[model samples]
Target: MDTQSAKDTVDIDLGGVSPCGEVIGDLGDDDMVTVLTGMKLNLAFFSEKVANLRNFVMHLETLGVELEGFVLDREDNDVDVGCVGKFLEFDLLCGVLGSEVVELDRFLDTLYAEIADAGERVTSCKPWQDNLLDPEQCLKQSEEQFSEIKKLSASFERTLSSYKRGGIGM
Candidate 1:
């Protein structure tokens, strides 16, 4: 059968319910499938980005610790001319890291909004009843990933705050 005819058949089989479900409004099976697949792909892409961000934050934390150590080591010595340049460099680097954390916090906010929107879309589609998608599993996976990102982001924020408080050097 042609695509249009096949869609008509499916619509008839659904007893007036569109294959896309009532909330989605008048989309055919192919369209619904495309949307669902796109949602899954987006979730996976965001999850990977979040993981990379987590790694970046952890690396920053390590750098902060090492810089703290360097500052402590220098504290015992008399202030040398060379130390002024090192302190300036350290201040500049800290400023860069602080700006990056602000950017990442904005990114996390966007991710949270996307996840919430996707969750609403997933729940609205009667996927479990229609056998269109596994809503429970998809939601569970996204929630788990989101929670992990939130926790990591919070920890990074705390670390960044301490760094800002002259934990490395005034």
Candidate 2:
């Protein structure tokens, strides 16, 4: 328990949960480094989920446009149950990400109004991905969700970037 020991520096408790959500453990400096690296890896996982969301939206658009064409020209893609399922899945994902989007938007709105707000260092993460594989295209489909999500994503990223660049200070 001496501060000279590398393990003493981090105050880790493998036996109990810390207020920060990390487990209390006898962590050495090396272990702390590993934890940080793991956190960075988790961030990559979040980015991939975001990309998956993007990919899904693209398919949704494709489906919607194709469905619209079908409606007009009698091409008939909606009669397929699978397409409906996929759209439903994207809707659920949208709900999940959109909640975070709302929170992020609000945080930015208030944060930006501050005269000396530090740019957001909030590290958001998606804990899981769930819902829908119902496809109508006879193959992987995501165009309908793609178009819808792309707009929200663009707005989110633009605002985030502005915050990063000291928009609050301006």
Candidate 3:
């Protein structure tokens, strides 16, 4: 899909505005810890997000397993080529999906650990395993995660720009 069309699917507009400028401008030298804590908390969401995706992929694998077993259990040696091909294709897709989920989970785990360690220096910004029972809570959590991600991106962009401008003092 083209860029505009792809964006239209979600339908969120930036209007060329970025939070980095506002966030960076609002930060004082003393608020570095706060900023770092916020970033760590925001980044920790990766673990939660990856875990959710892992669950979904594993659920897909379950369906694939059930369907494959059903087809194989039929003692008929003359299965249609199309049906066999579909099962094989589904299995292949499941394998790829499963492997990707594992890799992402591992990556998220490592990053989460690092962020947790860093967060200890400021405050514990660990992401919680949200067991939201109510729909309202779920919606609230989603909005909060989205805000954190946006803030994290803004802070990261600001930091990168600062380093590029020779302000990092390498």
Task: Return the TM-score for each candidate structure.
Answer: 0.52, 0.33, 0.39
lDDT of 1 by residue, 54-109 (tens): 66656655665665566566654445444445445545554555565566557656
Off by over 4 Å in 1: 1-17, 20-24, 76-170
Q: Residue-wise lDDT of candidate 3 within 30-96, one digit each (tens)?
A: 3544544454555446546644554654565565555456455555454555545545555455455
Candidate 2 per-residue lDDT, tens place, 1-170, comes to 44336346765544433223444355433444355445434334434545676765566455445533433443323244543454344444445656654554454344333211111111121111000111112111233343456576555445434423532212
TM-score of 2: 0.33
In order of lDDT, best first, we have 1, 3, 2
Best by lDDT: 1
- The alpha-carbon lDDT assigned to residue 64 of candidate 2 equals 48
lDDT of 1 at 119: 53
Task: Give all candidate RMSDs, comma-separated.
Answer: 5.9, 17.3, 20.9
